[model samples]
Target: MRAVIGIGNPGRNYIGTRHNVGFYILDSFAHKNKLDFLPTKSDFWKAESVIDTFRFLLIKPTTYVNNSGLVINELIDNFNLTMNDLLVIYDDVNLDIGNIRIRKNGSDGGHNGIKSIIYHLQSDSFPRIRVGVGKQKDDESLANYVLSKFNKDEINLIDQKIPLLEQLMIEFIANGYEKMLDYFSKESNTNSSNLS
Candidate 1:
């Protein structure tokens, strides 16, 4: 089985914040699939779904983003999942808004959430989707910027891209990261050709 963990703070106050994009994407995907997240006895809520013959779980950590690894570690053990069976989705301030980058494995790149997960898991061998939420201004504190809501235009841009993000996740569920990366590469080339 595979699992996709969406990292974010839990609660109403974080709903529209850039730091909550991971939760937003998972929520959208669950809603579209008619899956409802149910609270577990642990530190997360999960929606289970099957795509083709693949069974996967969509997880939202109930803990704050900085402590996300604790929840992920628990789930990994409970489900008997390996690093290859997990896919993490979270926001990246380094990329421009509306962009997303996928990777099989890597360092945290300064994300506390990823850093925590790495520290707990003791390896960077999982797949991840980094959704762009735009960089913080030089004058602003990174925490304040990430915890803030997006402007109307920024929100709309992300909304438009959510469908594609959902589809990309479906690909991850049905295949491993290699095939998913292939699909993304083809899609990117096609999109680039159309713009040229």
Candidate 2:
């Protein structure tokens, strides 16, 4: 089975926050596909379905952001999934807001969620889609910045790219990952998104 893990904190209190973009993306995709996220024995909300005989599971880790790797590990074992079969969707502050990056594998950079995943799995060889939340302002508290909701302009920026984000997610599902990276990379290049 193929699993896509969207790393973010749980609870209604976190909705619309910059840190919750991962959850937002997964929820949007699930809604588009007519799937409902149901509570699972695993530490995440899960939506399971099959598309053209390919089993797919969408996960939103309820373990919150910092300990995401624990939920990921559990899902892997429960689903008999390998690292290569998983794609993590997450937020990044390095890229410009509304930008997206796709990669087959790499270091977590400074992302605590990714760091947790790498620490738990002891490996970084997995696919990931990073949505840019833009760099924090110099005087802003990192924690405060990420946990805050996107401002009106930022929301407008991301809103314009939602369709493109959907396409990128679907590309991974339809074209498989290796080629999907190339596809997104090329797409980002032409559009100034920098899919690294």
Candidate 3:
């Protein structure tokens, strides 16, 4: 089974924060697909369903962002899932808003949650979708900036992008990273026009 893990801090206080974009995307995907996420004994909100030929488990790790790997590794072991069968979704500040970057394997690039995942899994061979949260101004504290909710304009952009990201995710699961990259890269280029 393929595992799609969305990383974010778990709490009502974190809802709508930039850092919770991962959870938002996954939730949107589940909603669009008519999948219900139920609380699991493993300390995660999970939804299991098959799309096309892919059998998938959608997971929102409840261990919070910093300790996300604990839940992810447990699920991986329990399900006997290979590294390649895993896909992590999380927010990245390095890219512009509404942009997504998919990488087959790489370092966390300063994302604490991803760092923890790599540390616990002892491998970086998994695929990942990095949703852009946009960079903050130089004077802003990183933590505060990430935890802050998006402004109205940003929210409008994100609202438009989430469904497109979901569609790209479906293609990623159905095809692979190369096809997804080709698709999203072109999509990003047309984002402005599409949003208009």
Q: What TM-score would every model get versus the actual structure?
A: 0.96, 0.93, 0.90
- Evaluated at residue 137, the lDDT of candidate 3 is 94
True-vs-predicted CA distance for residue 75, candidate 3, Å: 1.7
Best by TM-score: 1
Error of 1 at 182 (Å): 0.5
Off by over 4 Å in 1: 193-196
TM-score of 3: 0.90
Compose the digit string of candidate 3's lDDT tens values, residues 1-196: 7788998888899999999999988988998899998998887899999879878888998888888888867887888888877889999998777666788899999999999899998988888988888999999999998999988898787877777788777776777667777887787677664321
Ranking of models by lDDT: 1, 2, 3
Q: How many times do residue backbones clash in model 1?
A: 0
Comparing 2 and 3 by lDDT, which wins? 2
Error of 3 at 80 (Å): 2.2
| lDDT assessment of candidate 1 | 0.89
Across residues 99-127, which tens digit of lDDT does each residue of candidate 2 receive?
Answer: 88788778998899999999999999889
Q: Give the RMSD in angstroms, all C-alphas superposed, for model 1.
A: 2.0
